[model samples]
Target: MNRIEFMTELAALLQDVPVEERREAMQYYNDYFDDAGDENEEQVISELGSPAKVAATIKADLGSQAGDYAEYSENGYTDSRFDQKEMPAGRAYQRKEEKEPPKTSRALKIVLIIAIILVGAPVLIPLGVGITLAVLGCVIALFCAFIALVVASVAVAIVGIVVFGVGIATLIPELAVGLALVGTGLILTVLGVIATVASVKLCLVVFPGICRGIVWICRRPFQGKAVA
Candidate 1:
């Protein structure tokens, strides 16, 4: 049969189903044919089989889902054969469509949130401020500590250089003391150079990571608020 003949028969057969379900099923099939196009109409029709078969499948599915209930026609013909295995694939019949939340529920939720904000403003505001201040304080303290480490390393290196210079000046005056001083200076200078390099490398890794973490933390509250 052609699409028109098949769909017409299907609609008549589904008269016992609820109006909404019937309409959805008809719309689904109508859209299916349109999507298949005129060239593939015969193939689509053959795959779907007869309209009576389709209607039976729909009734069986709906009956099973409706739970031990019977659907009757105007002539009092009742259909009670509800086998779950008889359910149709790729059909809108008996499908559970997602429904949006009602306007009243949405409005109530918004009102409840506003009420909570208003009631808790005094305590919440101060608590939020304190938490923000604590975070900022910790970050600042950590940054200062790192800076101090870098500065201390540089300072040690400078001190080692100065001692080395003094040792060179004293070499001619006191050979033994000068040799000891020079050795001490060399060790100190090497230690200072290692410390400086380690401190700089650590800062390079830590600074960017800390900055990114701060940015993420700062954006979190705003992102949640915006989504709500």
Candidate 2:
């Protein structure tokens, strides 16, 4: 075939390649033809063989070169030359279509997917929503309960201090009872303080865990990773 026919066939064969790569391939062959001159065109085409064969050879070369580059990178040596080169252009990069899917099979696959989604939506959607709501409600309830414990502890401590102060201001005739009141108030104050500290510690530990558990449950259906 003539140069035009040969180049057209080569371009068709290289359609799966990136635009720039195809262009580079075409440029190389065009240069080869020009260097050979008009009289040598036939000889050069014969040397290159069929366009399909030439495209395959180019693909093989690129694959090997890429593997070598990867190996070099793994060995901690980057290839600066590869980084510096400009890309060639043609059609966008795409995986080679080995064979087109059967039209009937493709259509059937789409219909099947749609049908499955429609049939399952009523059950799956409600179930998912219910689970999410339940998890949120539980987390909120636990948080509120912890907050209540802290509030109650503080109130009890305050009442204990007020009783102790009243006892201290009483007359000498009631001094023994006043000392007893002081002891009772001290015990209440200590218990309240302990309760407050314990609740705070519980919140610090349990709140995050609950939050994480809720997050993990919510993401489970979407195939998302759980937090550590």
Candidate 3:
């Protein structure tokens, strides 16, 4: 986006916001692109990502939930199980007043870890098999590289004789071609060796990425925050 278009879009957004808040938000956004002067509005917009996304993030940062005092009771003990019981008027208090552990504390972390190991261990077995296959592919690449090295060495020896009669410049092209092929073969060999090594340690190296990908794909259908 050019500067003009970026300013135009920002102007549109500011129309929906209160006057005081609008000025503050625009100044914050203007400073974001001060260093990128004379760039097209499209480029500037792309760099900033979506305007709505940025605004939402800023709004969330500025708006914090106040502490809830009514969710607790004057009594020290909190009955988390939520069984209904009549309480005296003076006993009821806000939950924020209770200085207690977070819902995701040490015990919950342990339980989640144990549950995942128990459930996911079975799923990881197939991933272990895939890594084994990748290792075999690497072995094949190494053998091909070994063959290229041998052929390249033989070619170099013959070119030495050819250079004597053909002159140094004439042999240079042939030497360059041979070297290029050898270099390509060596690079492939290295890649194959790395893949093999990675496969052997699939659980540590490959499984996490695969799991994250799957989770991301599965989550695509459910987005957008609930208004309530």
Best by lDDT: 1
Model 1, 146-221: lDDT tens digits are 8899888888888888888888888999988888878878888888888999998998999899899989988999
Worst-scoring 10-residue span by lDDT in model 3 = 81-90
Residue pairs in clash, model 1? none
Local lDDT at 156 for model 2: 80
Superposed on all Cα atoms, model 2 deviates from the true structure by an RMSD in Å of 18.8
Local distance difference test, candidate 1: 0.76
TM-score-based ranking, best first?
Answer: 1, 2, 3
Q: Estimate each model's TM-score.
A: 0.55, 0.49, 0.24
- Superposed Cα deviation of residue 220, candidate 3 (Å): 80
User: Evaluated with TM-score, which candidate comes out highest?
Assistant: 1
lDDT measured at residue 23 in model 1 versus the true structure, 0 to 100:
78
lDDT of 2 by residue, 80-111 (tens): 22233231211122434469765677788999
- For every candidate structure, what is the RMSD over all alpha carbons to the true structure, in angstroms? 12.1, 18.8, 27.4
